[model samples]
Target chain A: MRPFLYERADQPEAAVIAARIQGQQQAPPTAAAAQFIAGGTTILDLMKLDVMQPQTLVNVGKLPGTIEMSDQGLRLGASVKMAEAAENEIVKRDFPVIAQALQLAASQQIRNMASLGGNVLQRTRCPYFRDVSYSACNKRNPGSGCSALDGHNRNLAILGTSDKCIASYPGDFAQALIALDAQVETLGPNGGRSLAFADLHKEPGDTPNIETQLQPGELISAFVVPTGAWTRRSLYLKIRDRESYEFALASAAIALDMDGQTVRGSRIALGGVATRPWRAREAEETINGQTLNDETARGAAEAAFRGAKVYSHNAFKVELGRRTLARALLDAGRMEI
Target chain B: MGFSMSQSEKPGGLNRRSFLTATAMGATLPVIQQARAQQAESAPADPRAPVDVKLRINGRDQSLRLDARTTLLDTLREHVGLTGSKKGCDQGQCGACTVLVDGTRVLSCLTLAVMAQGSEITTIEGLASSDGALHPMQQAFIDHDAFQCGYCTPGQIMSAVACVNEGHAGTNDDIREYMSGNLCRCAAYPNIVAAINQAKNEMRKA
Candidate 1:
């Protein structure tokens, strides 16, 4: 682990003071010399492996850790731990997709320590990016090259991949947030602002090193997920080699507003098969106003993966991802809401 | 008893160091191998300035100066002399470094010592009573033979206790799912589930 300076955060505005820069749009938040640390799960783990080496860390422990629900929707403070939000009564009852995504992620101890804010920002688990000994990662070392392109590409992304990087967005909760149309509130050196969750993550597009749209000093403050007719009917389904404590091989987050046996509306997001929390607008369009059935669900699933590009090892993901989405739709359709 | 070889491979005589290179001996890309190669010729990133950290462990406050790189697990083992918490995987992948921070289970390996200033940490050694009585979960593990080569037992026990407290141990399936964080290489999973079930009832009674 690299030695660095640590300062407890005084205020949101003050926290970013050290992190503020002139124009760092080209650099990822992980590349910032001074970064925010709350749960320290991602930053600490990567630092020990020498993946991320920030010169200074501003502890965000002083931020409010809260999960509150109202008539509008659910509001989760950035500091709320994954375990706390996963087991929150309102989240489990009103938004099963959010609850399931949090529950299925990481492990008991990791969920307890990791913050919901940081959970979405977790980097890919691409083996080449993790082990610095490889030295051929576009994300780790920009323009060095991508080893996963040819070597062990089983877990890489298919939906969002440039020739430079194929690292999949390794998060489930972000899929739920994107599907539910959550809005993220952020505090930066300039002040506070809100952005749609869908716009938060950037595609690899040649610059795999710059991951998020967040500025050098910006920090995620809260996530507000608006409730609707589909909120009670939503579910997140994850498929993996192991039942628990493992990253997703393929996953789906689905929310449907049903009109008896027909679908009134649909919201779909995919995971483990994309570069970011990918919104399957095509699948949602296919399912909306259509009668909910096995055949229709399969059609929507096929639409979801129509644009998938597969390499040598990860070609199975296109099929597996389709099945996972279809299964989520069928299961969610049959849900007793 | 901390040797890498687990002669008994049973309840009482499980060696903690069974978590070392013994099980991973012929594996490709072992973490230790990468760590060894990195240590010999890794990139220069060390600033190595000691920071003063005061931590409350098992109801006692201890103060020490440590590098910013020192994790809570290292502080407990090397600085404060609490070796009950093992470092199975120094990274957060394995839960062998599990401990309770402010009564909630967390991976000590991922928590930096300086950052854990205010929270009270409870490790495996703190589970026993002052009168020498073991925690119900510990007793239950012994009665159910929940471990063999008990390297991951501390983390498992800590996680199981938290699982029950968190009301995630309502059924056998719940126990299995919630306790999946702590990996037992000996595959003593069934026994661990039975132990958690037993202790859940006993803990409720107490």
Candidate 2:
């Protein structure tokens, strides 16, 4: 790891100011300056791999760590540990998909230490992305071309991909957040603001280097998920090579508000098969106002992967992704309340 | 246990205003006297300066002046001479460097020594009782033959203890899921699960 300045920030505003100051020191805005470190799971791992090199790190763990629930919905502070959020009684009862996604991610030890904000912003697990030796990664180096395009693309993205990058978003919780129409609250040098969870991550269209919409000094303050009739029925289904401690090969988050076997409303999202957290709006539209039988579930699943573009090595992901969605939908439909 | 920064008041009673003033001066001054004085004299010439870190390891307060790049794993094995925690991948991928920070299991290899300041850290060496009796988890691992090469034993034991404490050792599947972070290339997973279960029962009794 490279030598860097470490500054602990006890207050949220102070952390943002420190980051803004560090960012100004760098000549170019693109230069990696100050990064916020909460759990140190992603940042430290990338630093060790030499993939990410931030000159300064502002410790933002002291900002807040609350998981508040109210009539409106649940508000999860960014600093809350993944394990704490996953095991919270309100989270499990109100948003089973969120709990399941967090529980299914990484391992118990990692979940204990990783913060919710860091988890959502975690980088792709593409071997080429992690290994700096691959200089052709456009995400790592813009206009350098993507090695994973023809390289071992078995685990790469099949949807929301471009010629520039195909690294799949290897996270589970973000999928649930997007499905439930969650909102992200952020505090930065410019002050506080809220944005839809869908706007957090960017597609690898031209600038795969620019991953998130967050500015240099922006710190995710909290995530607010509005309560819905479908929230209780939501669930996340993950399919991986191993039953535990592994990234998903394909996963699905599904929530449905049903009226006597007919879908009154539906929200669907797919993971491990897309460039970003992908909300399957088309799939939801296909199933809404329709009965959630095997046929309808299969139709929705097919619709979810309709735009998937598979390479030679990842053609199986398209079918596997569809099956994951179908299975998740069926399982969520069978949930009692 | 008194290594917490929250417990230690600044000697000069510097408040937020004075701290901010010091930071501004440090940034502007080519050679800040106070900043230079705080750096470790033994630190090698490098762009990164050494930072003073205090940690409560095994219920004992310890202090070390280390470079900003030094990881908790390296600080323990190299500086503090507590080599019980093994570094498998030197990344967060492997749990060989697992340690309990403030009663929560975390990867010490990914954790910087400075970040662990003012936290209660429990390593493999701290697992046994003061009387030298083996920890229940350690005893169960021995009984179940949970390891072959023994390189990953310390981490496995630490994680197993945490898994039980976290109440994830109720059944075989739960144990396996919770203990998945600690991997043993010797393929001793079955034995590891058995050891964790046995230890859970023993600890419950105690």
- The prediction achieving the highest TM-score against the true structure is 2
In model 1 chain A, the worst 10-residue window by lDDT is A17-26
What residue pairs clash in candidate 1, if any at all? none
lDDT of 1 at A164: 93
lDDT of 2 by residue, A127-154 (tens): 8988999899988887899999899999
Give lDDT tens digits, candidate 2, residues B1-206: 11123213332122333334444533323323333343332122232767778889999999888888889999999998999999998887779999999989999998888888778999999999999999999999999999999999999999999999989999998988888899899999999999998899899998
Query: Which number leads on DockQ?
Result: 2
Candidate 2: where is the Cα deviation over 4 Å?
Answer: A25-31, B1-47
What's candidate 1's DockQ score?
Answer: 0.21
Which regions of candidate 1 fall more than 4 Å away from where they truly are? A21-26, A70-72, B1-47
TM-score of each: 0.90, 0.92
